[model samples]
Target chain A: MYYALQILIPLGLLMLGWGVGTLLERAHYRRIHRREDQHHHVPVTTERQLWNPDLPIAESRLVRGQVVVSVDYFKRFLAALRTLFGGEIHSYSSLLDRGRREAILRMREQFPHADVILNLRFETSTISAGGGRAMGTIEVLAYGTGVRYAQALRPPAVPDPAAD
Target chain B: MITTNIETVPGRTILEHYGIVQGSTIRAKHVGRDIAAGLKNLVGGELRGYTELLQEARDEAFSRMVDQAQEMGANAVVNVRFATSSVTSGASEILCYGTAVLVE
Candidate 1:
């Protein structure tokens, strides 16, 4: 039973990982697409200077977003096998793309009304588990300064409804 | 206080500046969070617990830096920068620094 148990456990785990991981990734992508469409008006830029050098700014503040993603069991095993061939690992590419896009979306979500975001930066790090060669998890960080024009933050001059 | 990573604030001018101010915090996740994160590894998705933990730690560091800037009588902190490192197996350190300044 020992050898049977050993062989069956990994096989079961691989199946479970593939089934659930794909579902989660698909749901995450759907949510990301919807939110990205919702926030189209907010602009983002990596330029150090303000988009409009002379634009009046009533408020400017720092904002950031962060994400941490781990590879599923099936992908990790696949990556381990991939090392033998020494080629591009498509799984990791998508993993990193998701992390980066999610991080940026969260950053944009922080300031839905931001006129522009400037000096954008990113920081990524990997956390290895159990001293394994396979990457265990990756964290993506995105930061920037959000700018609001002089009147951007002000309430409309509409007369109060109570007064009406 | 307003914080920006760039040398200039959009509509404000720097009148005076105080040298670099810094804040640092070291944090570790609790056992419950660690266990939850481990389970997430099976299917490879976001580790929400760790995300929240790190976010809290970073916010703490940012606030501490802002407090220092306020104590220095500065209205803004510019050219802000952040760095992080894993000090130990489970604990991480977050560092935030910026130049404090009075802007008009």
Candidate 2:
């Protein structure tokens, strides 16, 4: 009876602590995710120009520019698995988005008065490094071409809605 | 890959002296999950090991590759390559690399 009581009592306490810890961690993660999501990012309205609103803006042999941005981060073991389960993807996404935006902003800084940036393309890639049991970290690369052009004045080029 | 080195002609710029970017990962599941995985292995189905392990190694290797590129004054890496090898029965390594180049 004494053994059962000792073991059961401690086990129950452990379970309770674990549950609370999990709850706190999850809350923390969620809070961070939310704050990150809410972070002052470029308003979506800015990206709309990249999309052809009326199929009028098409250009070829246009001025071309490119920018590349990358971020490397290592997460704790548990966070790595949480990523596979779709729990931690948002964090990475946010990080990538932030990086891309900064890159674009830099481009814009280069050419501040441009009306529209045509032929804008963004690419992201990841690679694995070591043969081990735990996932060490994640590296994200974002690259794109930033162009300045006027829709009506731009040349008639390929129209691929799927480009976006 | 982008390198700041001025290559007037043809010559190996040597982006990274190591000639490799490496990422390694190790994972042991949560206690309960480990027990479950061990038991499930008997049934011969998908195991969660790869998911976690690969993710980690990939990240580490990527960081290393970037570090190497940075050391070379590369602003960007192009033509990236990825290779994997099984280090042990249950462990693996994921290495990623690319050409570091300088963009004008």
Candidate 3:
């Protein structure tokens, strides 16, 4: 009975972790997609120069957002197995995508008035709480300069003939 | 104070350069948060606790860098950069640096 209990416990835990992990990942991806669609109008770019060079700059400030994501036990196990074979770890790809997208979304949400974000940069690192053997937490940080255009200098849609 | 990752602040003139100012902070995760993150790892999603932790650390580092700029009597910090690395199993360090400048 003792031996049977030990074998069953780990198996049960693995199964539970797998089920919950999949559900959470799906939900997170759904949220990320919805938010991305909502903020599609906000232009986020890595260009060193401003998107609209003609627009007069009113204010520019630094903005940043960060996200930390962890790999599930089941995925980690799979990743370990894949490591031995030395191939692409598909599970980790989604994990990184979620972190990066979430970080950018948070930064975008912070500055509604900004015309665009320029010089965007991303930094990622791993945080392992336990021994090196365990899967570590991954952190993604997205930062950029939020440039707000001068409202007073906004160009008119049509030329004013009377002024001319 | 004006802070930007860009090398120059648009529409502003830089008068004086104050060299590079930097700040860093190392943080360790609490047991409770670790356990929560562990559970989160099972499903594989965003770990809010760790996210908030890192955000706070970043903010602190930025503020410290700004304070250094203020000490140097600069009005802005340009070409700002951020980095992170794990010091140990649970602890990580957040570092921020920038070139301090007096702008008009």
Q: Please state the error at residue A128 of candidate 1 in Å.
A: 3.6
Q: What is the lDDT for A38 in model 1?
A: 88
TM-score of chain A of each: 0.86, 0.36, 0.86
Docking class of 1: medium
What TM-score would you give candidate 2 relative to the actual structure?
0.31
| Interface C-alpha RMSD after superposing true interface residues, each candidate, one decimal | 1.7, 15.8, 1.6
Candidate 2 residue-wise lDDT, A9-99, digit = tens: 7566545434554454355446545644543232222232344344332221111112222112222223455766865454345345444
TM-score of chain B of each: 0.97, 0.59, 0.97
Off by over 4 Å in 2: A1-164, B1-34, B39-49
**DockQ-based CAPRI category assigned to the predicted complex of candidate 2:** incorrect
| Native contact fraction (fnat) of model 3 | 0.85
lDDT per prediction? 0.84, 0.40, 0.85
What TM-score, to 2 decimals, does candidate 3 have? 0.90
Model 1's i-RMS, to one decimal, reads 1.7
A36-85: candidate 3 lDDT, tens digit per residue: 89877667889878645766689999988888888787788788889899
Best by TM-score: 1
Candidate 3 Cα errors over 4 Å, as ranges: A134-136, A152-164
Enumerate residue pairs that collide in model 1.
none
